[model samples]
Target: MHLTLGLHRAVRHEPSSVATFYEGRTHTFRQLADRVARLAGALRTIGVKTGDRVAILALNSDRYIEYYLAVWWAGAVVNPINTRWATPEILYSLDDSQSEVMFVDSAHKSKIDELREGSTTLEHIIYLDEEEKPNGTLSYEDLIEDGEPIEDSYRHGDDIAGIFYTGGTTGFPKGVMLSHTNIGVPAMTFLCEEYGFGSVSLHTAPLFHVAPLMYVIAQLFNGGRHIVLSGFEPAQVARAIEERKVTDVLLVPSMLHVLLDSPVVQKTNFSGLRRIWYGGSPIAETTQRRALEVFQPSGLVQLYGLTEIPVVALLSAAWHAPEMRKLRSTGRAAQENEIMIADANGREVPRGSIGEIVARGPNVMKGYWNKPVETETAIRNGWLWTGDAGYMDDDGFVFIADRFKDMIVTGGENVYAAEVENAIAKHPAVAACSVIGIPSHEWGESVHAVVVLKPGAREFTVEEIRHHCKDLIGGYKSPRSIEFKPSLPLSAFGKVVKDELRAPFWRDAIRKV
Candidate 1:
């Protein structure tokens, strides 16, 4: 299936229906379709070809939706750079994907000169904002107005649709190649689940992330009205839901906590909300209980998956009941997915035995761009090894035990330990360092670093280490807490034992993950 098929269906069925809302502006389906077609034509005029990569580095807005649809309409692969990425990380993704054209908004336009110098393939920059266009950058409105509307490119099936960059285990980033089928399957599946036609969905989560991006695609199929927020601010989210009568929203556990804690939640009326789809990280039982009281009519759902495979399993509202005893589980596999717990030898482990979670389905990503070896390792025997440790119960519910991968999910964003370790290792006063996730009530888990100072070297402060890492990584990926240790625990193989570092912090926790 083509990624743009939903947009075509929506426009044909309800041309005059409200399609998107951002700030004080609104657009109908016909208007959105017309703009998308013109933008696609403009892209072609600017030398964008079918299968070429187009990148966008901007916050969530109505324009973000347009860019996503326009790129797919143009039959080009989208390379959405993470908004939280540092300049080097952003440049690396752009260069790795060979993106010829990139769109930037007012918040990120200041780095255009540096990005241009660092990127090997970047040729054009489009300013996506109401503000005056910067010198040497193309104006977003002028391009749409000047170009002719074009027909859909009609790319479909196994054709590559987007290249999403995710944190790498090797202290770099991996460009995850997803085909039309990889994204379309999940979008279609959502129609049979909680989302339906005419649902008013809120886009508070970052659009660049897979979870939020998939939600956008799912809404397009149903002709739902999208209420776009620049970012997730508790006050803004609560006000939008109350004013727009938003029916659905997706948030990570951390975001949910902050929103519930904010004073605005109690004052806002969210009676129109039908579902709260939470994922990206596990939620604390205390937080979930509080949510039930606050959002009485809204059902709580848990979506379990990663960027590589967007749809795997979903814990429905019923399973969240206190008597269900499956509240801690990630729920059964999706209708189209086949999931199992596998041992090290690639053999399926018996039910109730903890093992690595493995899955195979149309939702699985095609591969990592330009990394055949890593692809083979990830998708061995037609199953995508998730690197997440979990077990399935007799009733098919999957319980998350721990993570096998050297990764952390803090505030729903994946942070590879090696990436932070690599950054900290660059400090002049540090002799050795190991990064790990510590139990956090606020972020679910927080990045923590254990360092050993070099002999005869000046003692380094937490502020100094954080300042050094700011230029190398995102603020969220940097350590929130630091511990100075004499040495790190090592295994017989001489590799740092991260579990040992994480043990003390999680000892009294309800869940290990």
Candidate 2:
């Protein structure tokens, strides 16, 4: 089936049902389908065709939603731009994808002239904002009015559907080539599992990221409505959920904290909320505890995956056991794939042994776009090496230790960030924490942690934090030093930007990330 079949199926099932609550507009599936068709026709009129790449640089607006469906319906691969990125990064992805056309929202519309000046691959531009291009460049709505719905170019079963670029702040980004089957398989995996398969999903997470996009496609395939938030605001999210009776919402750890602490948490009715799914970063027990208390009716589900795999493990709704609360472990693998830990030799490690996590499944991406060598290094012998330090317990639950990049090797001893983060999280004063390896002359690399203290809590010194965690975990695992910050810099996915945090430490030094 074509990826666009989801939209068609939803319209057929409940044409009049609300399909999207975006910005100030509400749309039913029928209306959405009509707009998608019109927009697709418009895209085609502007020379979009099968296998073509179209970039969208916009916030999570109603227009962005329309662009998603219309791009696919036009038989083009959707390349959603990371709006948070600077001009150079945005230009990199657009140039890499060779996207012929771009759709810029009102906010970023002003930057087009500057970006377009040096760009060679961008042949056309369309503005989704109210102020159209002073030149004859097309407006988003006008393109829809100028064209007709072409036949459903159902590029299913291995045909490329989307080119999702990884957030490569450290270096150049690689485009993940996802086939129709890759995403179709995962969408069906959730549906077959009946984990709120077809329910309203709030898009507080950036739509450009894989986590939210996976849900957007999955929920759509399962005949669910999507409530698109232009951008995440705790109060606004709570209000939308309360007003729409939203069934499910996805968050990463930091956003989870924001919601629990928001005044809206007390005022908004969470009665309609069924489940709260979180991932992209480790969930602190404190954050989870607060979340459980605030979003009472909503059960928390954690999913773990990399950009290459899209999604791999699902810590199912079953693991939310009252007894399992303190374990801090991701549940057993989802039904879609097999999860195993591999050591340095590429051999599977025994249960309870820590190693790199690997998986082999249909849901995994085809490969990195235009990077054969990197793709080969990541996916060997049909298994994708997730670059995550982890272990499987006797119950088959997978415990993630840390990313291969974030693991600190001090005097040949491997230290995990998750371990230090967990230990710091136990401190009564720490609201959130992150551990990163900084340049150290004596040990090669030393652990340095940055912490966010709870409001009104007295400041603790670096020595105090190190002394506290020295006994809980290994002495070597304790951070060599701690730096208290007002807050941690989190990505759109809510994962701490450790590389960014540590950049100043290695600016002129010979150290590797």
lDDT of each: 0.91, 0.76
- 246: Cα error in model 2, Å: 0.5
Clashes of each: 0, 0
Runs in model 1 lying further than 4 Å from the true structure: none
List, residue by residue over 15-89, the lDDT tens digit for candidate 1: 999999999999999999999999999999999999999999999999999999999999899999899988989
Error of 1 at 294 (Å): 1.0
The parts of candidate 2 lying over 4 Å away from their true place are: 131-136, 167-170, 325-327, 406-513
Model 2 residue 198 lDDT score = 51
RMSD of 2: 11.2
* Cα lDDT for residue 150, candidate 2: 67
Candidate 2 clash figure, as a count: 0
TM-score, one value per model: 0.98, 0.79
